[model samples]
Target: MDEIIQEDKKVFLYLNNLGDPSFDQLWMLISSTWIWVPLYIIFLYFLYKNYQLRSLVFILIFLALGATVSDQLANVFKYGVARLRPCHDPSLEHYMRIVKCGGQYGFYSAHASNTFFLASYLGILLKKKIKWFPYAIFVWAIVVSYSRIYLGVHFPIDVLVGAFAGSLLGVIFSVLAQKVINKQKITP
Candidate 1:
Protein backbone atom coordinates (compact mmCIF):
# COMPACT_ATOMS: atom_id res chain seq x y z
CA MET A 1 0.00 0.00 0.00
CA ASP A 2 2.78 2.39 0.92
CA GLU A 3 4.75 1.59 -2.23
CA ILE A 4 1.71 2.14 -4.41
CA ILE A 5 0.98 5.44 -2.72
CA GLN A 6 4.58 6.56 -3.19
CA GLU A 7 4.45 5.65 -6.86
CA ASP A 8 1.23 7.56 -7.29
CA LYS A 9 2.79 10.57 -5.64
CA LYS A 10 5.67 10.40 -8.07
CA VAL A 11 3.24 10.36 -10.97
CA PHE A 12 1.37 13.31 -9.50
CA LEU A 13 4.57 15.28 -9.17
CA TYR A 14 5.54 14.53 -12.75
CA LEU A 15 2.17 15.67 -14.03
CA ASN A 16 2.11 18.79 -11.87
CA ASN A 17 5.44 19.90 -13.32
CA LEU A 18 3.95 19.99 -16.82
CA GLY A 19 1.45 22.76 -16.02
CA ASP A 20 0.96 25.63 -18.47
CA PRO A 21 0.41 29.13 -17.02
CA SER A 22 -2.22 29.96 -19.65
CA PHE A 23 -4.25 26.91 -18.82
CA ASP A 24 -3.94 27.72 -15.13
CA GLN A 25 -5.28 31.22 -15.72
CA LEU A 26 -8.17 29.88 -17.76
CA TRP A 27 -8.96 27.30 -15.15
CA MET A 28 -9.00 29.90 -12.39
CA LEU A 29 -11.32 32.12 -14.38
CA ILE A 30 -13.82 29.39 -15.18
CA SER A 31 -13.74 27.78 -11.75
CA SER A 32 -14.79 30.97 -10.03
CA THR A 33 -18.21 30.63 -8.42
CA TRP A 34 -19.06 34.18 -9.50
CA ILE A 35 -19.54 32.88 -13.05
CA TRP A 36 -20.98 29.43 -12.25
CA VAL A 37 -23.35 30.62 -9.55
CA PRO A 38 -25.23 32.96 -11.87
CA LEU A 39 -25.31 30.21 -14.45
CA TYR A 40 -26.75 27.84 -11.89
CA ILE A 41 -29.38 30.32 -10.90
CA ILE A 42 -30.30 30.90 -14.52
CA PHE A 43 -30.69 27.18 -15.03
CA LEU A 44 -32.95 26.91 -12.02
CA TYR A 45 -34.96 29.87 -13.19
CA PHE A 46 -35.40 28.31 -16.61
CA LEU A 47 -36.51 25.07 -15.05
CA TYR A 48 -39.03 26.85 -12.88
CA LYS A 49 -40.34 28.86 -15.80
CA ASN A 50 -40.59 25.94 -18.22
CA TYR A 51 -41.32 22.97 -15.98
CA GLN A 52 -44.05 22.24 -13.49
CA LEU A 53 -43.85 24.08 -10.20
CA ARG A 54 -43.73 20.84 -8.23
CA SER A 55 -40.83 19.58 -10.29
CA LEU A 56 -38.94 22.82 -9.86
CA VAL A 57 -39.40 22.71 -6.12
CA PHE A 58 -38.34 19.11 -5.85
CA ILE A 59 -35.28 19.54 -8.07
CA LEU A 60 -34.15 22.68 -6.30
CA ILE A 61 -34.49 21.03 -2.92
CA PHE A 62 -32.63 17.96 -4.07
CA LEU A 63 -29.88 20.05 -5.64
CA ALA A 64 -29.33 21.98 -2.44
CA LEU A 65 -29.36 18.85 -0.34
CA GLY A 66 -26.93 17.12 -2.69
CA ALA A 67 -24.52 20.05 -2.59
CA THR A 68 -24.59 20.26 1.19
CA VAL A 69 -24.02 16.55 1.65
CA SER A 70 -21.24 16.43 -0.95
CA ASP A 71 -19.45 19.37 0.66
CA GLN A 72 -19.59 17.85 4.12
CA LEU A 73 -18.35 14.52 2.86
CA ALA A 74 -15.38 16.19 1.16
CA ASN A 75 -14.60 18.07 4.35
CA VAL A 76 -14.69 14.88 6.35
CA PHE A 77 -12.24 13.24 3.98
CA LYS A 78 -9.96 16.24 4.04
CA TYR A 79 -9.67 16.33 7.83
CA GLY A 80 -9.62 12.58 8.30
CA VAL A 81 -6.90 11.94 5.76
CA ALA A 82 -4.87 15.05 6.67
CA ARG A 83 -2.77 14.86 3.52
CA LEU A 84 -0.79 17.88 2.36
CA ARG A 85 -1.70 19.86 -0.72
CA PRO A 86 0.73 19.50 -3.61
CA CYS A 87 1.77 23.12 -3.31
CA HIS A 88 2.70 22.52 0.29
CA ASP A 89 4.23 19.10 -0.18
CA PRO A 90 7.99 19.43 -0.43
CA SER A 91 8.32 16.00 -2.01
CA LEU A 92 6.41 17.09 -5.11
CA GLU A 93 8.11 19.04 -7.88
CA HIS A 94 6.19 22.24 -8.50
CA TYR A 95 6.17 24.22 -11.74
CA MET A 96 2.82 25.90 -11.97
CA ARG A 97 1.89 29.20 -10.33
CA ILE A 98 0.37 28.60 -6.94
CA VAL A 99 -2.66 30.72 -6.19
CA LYS A 100 -2.66 29.52 -2.61
CA CYS A 101 -2.10 26.29 -0.82
CA GLY A 102 -5.55 25.24 0.28
CA GLY A 103 -6.46 23.17 3.34
CA GLN A 104 -4.02 20.71 4.80
CA TYR A 105 -5.26 17.73 2.80
CA GLY A 106 -5.36 17.26 -0.95
CA PHE A 107 -6.53 13.66 -0.96
CA TYR A 108 -9.91 14.85 -2.33
CA SER A 109 -10.71 18.19 -3.89
CA ALA A 110 -13.72 20.15 -2.60
CA HIS A 111 -14.16 22.14 -5.82
CA ALA A 112 -14.27 18.96 -7.84
CA SER A 113 -16.69 17.37 -5.43
CA ASN A 114 -19.05 20.34 -5.28
CA THR A 115 -19.11 21.05 -9.01
CA PHE A 116 -19.53 17.36 -9.80
CA PHE A 117 -22.44 17.12 -7.41
CA LEU A 118 -24.06 20.15 -9.02
CA ALA A 119 -23.47 18.78 -12.50
CA SER A 120 -24.85 15.36 -11.67
CA TYR A 121 -27.91 16.74 -9.92
CA LEU A 122 -28.71 19.17 -12.73
CA GLY A 123 -28.00 16.61 -15.43
CA ILE A 124 -30.42 14.15 -13.86
CA LEU A 125 -33.10 16.81 -13.47
CA LEU A 126 -32.72 18.09 -17.04
CA LYS A 127 -32.11 14.77 -18.77
CA LYS A 128 -35.28 14.86 -20.86
CA LYS A 129 -35.24 18.37 -22.33
CA ILE A 130 -31.51 18.49 -22.97
CA LYS A 131 -29.86 15.46 -24.43
CA TRP A 132 -26.55 17.24 -24.13
CA PHE A 133 -26.92 18.00 -20.42
CA PRO A 134 -24.94 14.98 -19.33
CA TYR A 135 -22.11 15.78 -21.73
CA ALA A 136 -22.01 19.37 -20.56
CA ILE A 137 -21.99 18.21 -16.96
CA PHE A 138 -19.09 15.90 -17.74
CA VAL A 139 -17.16 18.70 -19.37
CA TRP A 140 -17.72 20.92 -16.37
CA ALA A 141 -16.74 18.17 -13.99
CA ILE A 142 -13.51 17.50 -15.85
CA VAL A 143 -12.65 21.16 -16.01
CA VAL A 144 -13.31 21.72 -12.33
CA SER A 145 -11.30 18.67 -11.37
CA TYR A 146 -8.44 19.63 -13.63
CA SER A 147 -8.37 23.15 -12.25
CA ARG A 148 -7.16 21.83 -8.91
CA ILE A 149 -4.24 20.18 -10.66
CA TYR A 150 -3.53 23.18 -12.85
CA LEU A 151 -3.49 25.37 -9.76
CA GLY A 152 -0.96 23.00 -8.16
CA VAL A 153 -3.26 22.12 -5.31
CA HIS A 154 -4.57 18.57 -5.83
CA PHE A 155 -3.19 15.40 -7.35
CA PRO A 156 -4.96 13.75 -10.28
CA ILE A 157 -6.14 10.84 -8.14
CA ASP A 158 -7.51 13.28 -5.61
CA VAL A 159 -9.63 14.94 -8.27
CA LEU A 160 -10.74 11.60 -9.72
CA VAL A 161 -11.81 10.25 -6.34
CA GLY A 162 -13.57 13.50 -5.52
CA ALA A 163 -15.50 13.35 -8.81
CA PHE A 164 -16.51 9.74 -8.24
CA ALA A 165 -17.50 10.28 -4.65
CA GLY A 166 -19.47 13.42 -5.40
CA SER A 167 -21.32 11.90 -8.33
CA LEU A 168 -22.29 8.88 -6.26
CA LEU A 169 -23.49 11.11 -3.44
CA GLY A 170 -25.52 13.24 -5.83
CA VAL A 171 -27.28 10.20 -7.33
CA ILE A 172 -27.93 8.69 -3.95
CA PHE A 173 -29.38 11.90 -2.58
CA SER A 174 -31.59 12.44 -5.63
CA VAL A 175 -33.06 8.97 -5.30
CA LEU A 176 -33.54 9.38 -1.59
CA ALA A 177 -35.18 12.76 -2.03
CA GLN A 178 -37.59 11.41 -4.63
CA LYS A 179 -38.52 8.51 -2.40
CA VAL A 180 -39.19 10.82 0.50
CA ILE A 181 -41.33 13.08 -1.65
CA ASN A 182 -43.31 10.11 -2.93
CA LYS A 183 -43.95 8.87 0.60
CA GLN A 184 -45.09 12.32 1.71
CA LYS A 185 -47.52 12.52 -1.18
CA ILE A 186 -49.00 9.14 -0.39
CA THR A 187 -49.47 9.97 3.30
CA PRO A 188 -50.78 13.55 3.07
Candidate 2:
Protein backbone atom coordinates (compact mmCIF):
# COMPACT_ATOMS: atom_id res chain seq x y z
CA MET A 1 0.00 0.00 0.00
CA ASP A 2 2.82 2.40 0.84
CA GLU A 3 4.59 1.61 -2.42
CA ILE A 4 1.35 2.18 -4.35
CA ILE A 5 0.82 5.49 -2.63
CA GLN A 6 4.35 6.58 -3.41
CA GLU A 7 3.79 5.70 -7.04
CA ASP A 8 0.55 7.64 -7.06
CA LYS A 9 2.33 10.69 -5.73
CA LYS A 10 5.06 10.34 -8.32
CA VAL A 11 2.51 10.12 -11.10
CA PHE A 12 0.56 13.05 -9.78
CA LEU A 13 3.65 15.20 -9.65
CA TYR A 14 4.66 14.24 -13.17
CA LEU A 15 1.25 15.11 -14.57
CA ASN A 16 0.66 18.20 -12.51
CA ASN A 17 4.03 19.70 -13.40
CA LEU A 18 3.20 19.50 -17.08
CA GLY A 19 0.81 22.41 -16.77
CA ASP A 20 1.74 25.89 -18.03
CA PRO A 21 0.34 29.22 -16.92
CA SER A 22 -0.84 29.91 -20.46
CA PHE A 23 -3.15 26.88 -20.38
CA ASP A 24 -4.26 27.33 -16.77
CA GLN A 25 -7.25 29.43 -17.66
CA LEU A 26 -8.38 26.95 -20.27
CA TRP A 27 -8.14 24.09 -17.82
CA MET A 28 -9.84 26.12 -15.10
CA LEU A 29 -12.71 26.83 -17.43
CA ILE A 30 -12.91 23.19 -18.36
CA SER A 31 -12.89 22.21 -14.69
CA SER A 32 -15.82 24.47 -13.90
CA THR A 33 -19.19 22.72 -13.94
CA TRP A 34 -21.08 25.82 -15.00
CA ILE A 35 -18.89 26.20 -18.07
CA TRP A 36 -20.33 22.94 -19.35
CA VAL A 37 -23.95 24.04 -19.18
CA PRO A 38 -24.10 24.56 -22.91
CA LEU A 39 -22.72 21.08 -23.41
CA TYR A 40 -25.32 19.69 -21.06
CA ILE A 41 -27.99 21.49 -23.00
CA ILE A 42 -26.63 19.94 -26.17
CA PHE A 43 -26.81 16.54 -24.51
CA LEU A 44 -30.42 17.25 -23.66
CA TYR A 45 -31.06 18.09 -27.27
CA PHE A 46 -29.65 14.73 -28.29
CA LEU A 47 -31.80 12.93 -25.72
CA TYR A 48 -34.83 14.84 -26.89
CA LYS A 49 -34.13 13.96 -30.46
CA ASN A 50 -33.60 10.27 -29.74
CA TYR A 51 -36.28 9.35 -27.23
CA GLN A 52 -40.00 9.95 -27.02
CA LEU A 53 -41.46 12.24 -24.34
CA ARG A 54 -42.27 9.66 -21.66
CA SER A 55 -39.09 7.69 -22.19
CA LEU A 56 -37.01 10.87 -22.18
CA VAL A 57 -38.49 11.89 -18.82
CA PHE A 58 -37.62 8.55 -17.29
CA ILE A 59 -34.13 8.68 -18.75
CA LEU A 60 -33.60 12.17 -17.41
CA ILE A 61 -34.77 11.07 -13.99
CA PHE A 62 -32.35 8.17 -14.03
CA LEU A 63 -29.57 10.52 -15.08
CA ALA A 64 -30.31 12.82 -12.15
CA LEU A 65 -30.44 9.92 -9.72
CA GLY A 66 -27.23 8.42 -11.09
CA ALA A 67 -25.40 11.74 -10.91
CA THR A 68 -26.52 12.25 -7.31
CA VAL A 69 -25.44 8.76 -6.40
CA SER A 70 -22.04 9.18 -8.06
CA ASP A 71 -21.36 12.51 -6.35
CA GLN A 72 -22.49 11.46 -2.87
CA LEU A 73 -20.73 8.15 -3.09
CA ALA A 74 -17.49 9.97 -3.92
CA ASN A 75 -18.02 12.19 -0.88
CA VAL A 76 -18.41 9.11 1.26
CA PHE A 77 -15.15 7.69 -0.05
CA LYS A 78 -13.34 11.00 0.31
CA TYR A 79 -14.11 11.33 4.00
CA GLY A 80 -14.03 7.65 4.77
CA VAL A 81 -10.63 7.12 3.15
CA ALA A 82 -9.31 10.43 4.49
CA ARG A 83 -6.81 10.81 1.67
CA LEU A 84 -5.41 14.31 1.34
CA ARG A 85 -5.67 16.07 -1.97
CA PRO A 86 -2.39 16.99 -3.65
CA CYS A 87 -2.80 20.70 -2.97
CA HIS A 88 -3.62 20.05 0.68
CA ASP A 89 -0.76 17.62 1.28
CA PRO A 90 2.03 19.18 3.31
CA SER A 91 4.76 17.23 1.55
CA LEU A 92 3.59 18.15 -1.95
CA GLU A 93 2.56 21.72 -1.26
CA HIS A 94 5.89 23.14 -2.38
CA TYR A 95 6.42 20.69 -5.25
CA MET A 96 2.98 21.00 -6.83
CA ARG A 97 1.72 23.89 -8.95
CA ILE A 98 -1.54 24.22 -7.04
CA VAL A 99 -3.40 25.89 -9.86
CA LYS A 100 -6.62 25.33 -7.93
CA CYS A 101 -7.20 23.90 -4.50
CA GLY A 102 -10.27 21.99 -3.46
CA GLY A 103 -11.32 20.39 -0.17
CA GLN A 104 -8.88 18.61 2.10
CA TYR A 105 -9.81 15.10 1.13
CA GLY A 106 -9.74 13.82 -2.43
CA PHE A 107 -9.60 10.05 -2.32
CA TYR A 108 -11.90 10.12 -5.27
CA SER A 109 -13.04 13.19 -7.18
CA ALA A 110 -16.75 13.99 -7.42
CA HIS A 111 -16.17 15.96 -10.60
CA ALA A 112 -14.63 12.93 -12.26
CA SER A 113 -17.36 10.74 -10.89
CA ASN A 114 -20.18 12.96 -12.10
CA THR A 115 -18.75 13.54 -15.56
CA PHE A 116 -17.86 9.89 -16.13
CA PHE A 117 -21.26 8.86 -14.86
CA LEU A 118 -22.94 11.03 -17.45
CA ALA A 119 -20.65 9.75 -20.18
CA SER A 120 -21.17 6.11 -19.32
CA TYR A 121 -24.91 6.34 -18.72
CA LEU A 122 -25.68 8.39 -21.79
CA GLY A 123 -23.19 6.48 -23.93
CA ILE A 124 -24.95 3.22 -23.21
CA LEU A 125 -28.44 4.69 -23.52
CA LEU A 126 -27.78 6.44 -26.80
CA LYS A 127 -25.20 4.15 -28.42
CA LYS A 128 -27.63 2.62 -30.88
CA LYS A 129 -29.39 5.86 -31.64
CA ILE A 130 -26.28 7.92 -32.27
CA LYS A 131 -23.35 5.80 -33.31
CA TRP A 132 -20.65 8.35 -32.50
CA PHE A 133 -22.05 9.48 -29.17
CA PRO A 134 -20.37 6.95 -26.92
CA TYR A 135 -16.94 7.67 -28.34
CA ALA A 136 -17.39 11.41 -28.12
CA ILE A 137 -18.80 11.40 -24.61
CA PHE A 138 -16.11 9.08 -23.28
CA VAL A 139 -13.51 11.43 -24.73
CA TRP A 140 -15.21 14.29 -22.99
CA ALA A 141 -15.20 12.40 -19.71
CA ILE A 142 -11.47 11.67 -20.08
CA VAL A 143 -10.74 15.34 -20.65
CA VAL A 144 -12.75 16.31 -17.59
CA SER A 145 -11.03 13.71 -15.46
CA TYR A 146 -7.62 14.88 -16.67
CA SER A 147 -8.53 18.46 -15.80
CA ARG A 148 -8.75 17.47 -12.14
CA ILE A 149 -5.21 16.23 -12.28
CA TYR A 150 -3.98 19.18 -14.33
CA LEU A 151 -5.37 21.54 -11.70
CA GLY A 152 -3.47 19.66 -8.98
CA VAL A 153 -6.66 18.95 -7.07
CA HIS A 154 -6.69 15.16 -7.48
CA PHE A 155 -4.22 12.35 -7.93
CA PRO A 156 -4.43 9.99 -10.87
CA ILE A 157 -5.63 7.24 -8.55
CA ASP A 158 -8.41 9.44 -7.26
CA VAL A 159 -9.70 10.15 -10.74
CA LEU A 160 -9.29 6.52 -11.79
CA VAL A 161 -11.26 5.24 -8.83
CA GLY A 162 -13.95 7.82 -9.36
CA ALA A 163 -14.19 6.92 -13.04
CA PHE A 164 -14.51 3.23 -12.23
CA ALA A 165 -17.17 3.80 -9.58
CA GLY A 166 -19.08 6.24 -11.73
CA SER A 167 -19.02 3.87 -14.69
CA LEU A 168 -20.37 1.10 -12.50
CA LEU A 169 -23.20 3.29 -11.30
CA GLY A 170 -23.90 4.36 -14.85
CA VAL A 171 -24.27 0.77 -16.00
CA ILE A 172 -26.48 -0.09 -13.07
CA PHE A 173 -28.75 2.92 -13.56
CA SER A 174 -28.92 2.45 -17.31
CA VAL A 175 -30.12 -1.10 -16.79
CA LEU A 176 -32.74 0.06 -14.33
CA ALA A 177 -33.88 2.79 -16.70
CA GLN A 178 -34.28 0.28 -19.52
CA LYS A 179 -36.28 -2.04 -17.29
CA VAL A 180 -38.61 0.73 -16.23
CA ILE A 181 -39.08 1.89 -19.79
CA ASN A 182 -39.87 -1.63 -20.89
CA LYS A 183 -42.31 -2.17 -18.03
CA GLN A 184 -44.09 1.05 -18.92
CA LYS A 185 -44.10 0.12 -22.61
CA ILE A 186 -42.54 3.45 -23.49
CA THR A 187 -40.78 3.32 -26.83
CA PRO A 188 -37.67 5.36 -27.42
Candidate topping lDDT: 2
* Clash list (residue pairs), candidate 2: none
| Tens-place lDDT digits, model 1, residues 1-188 | 77867866777666666766657667777767687877777777756665566655676788787888888888899889988888887766454457546776887888889888877776765677778877887797888787777777887778888899888887887677667657667321
My TM-score estimates for the predictions, one after another, are 0.86, 0.98
lDDT of 2 by residue, 1-188 (tens): 99999999999999999999999999999999999999999999999999999999999999999999999999999999999999999999889899999999999989889988999899999999999999999999999999999999999999999999999999999999999999999989
Each prediction's Cα RMSD? 2.9, 0.7
Error of 1 at 68 (Å): 0.7
- Over 4 Å off in model 2, which ranges? none
Alpha carbon lDDT at 1, candidate 1: 75
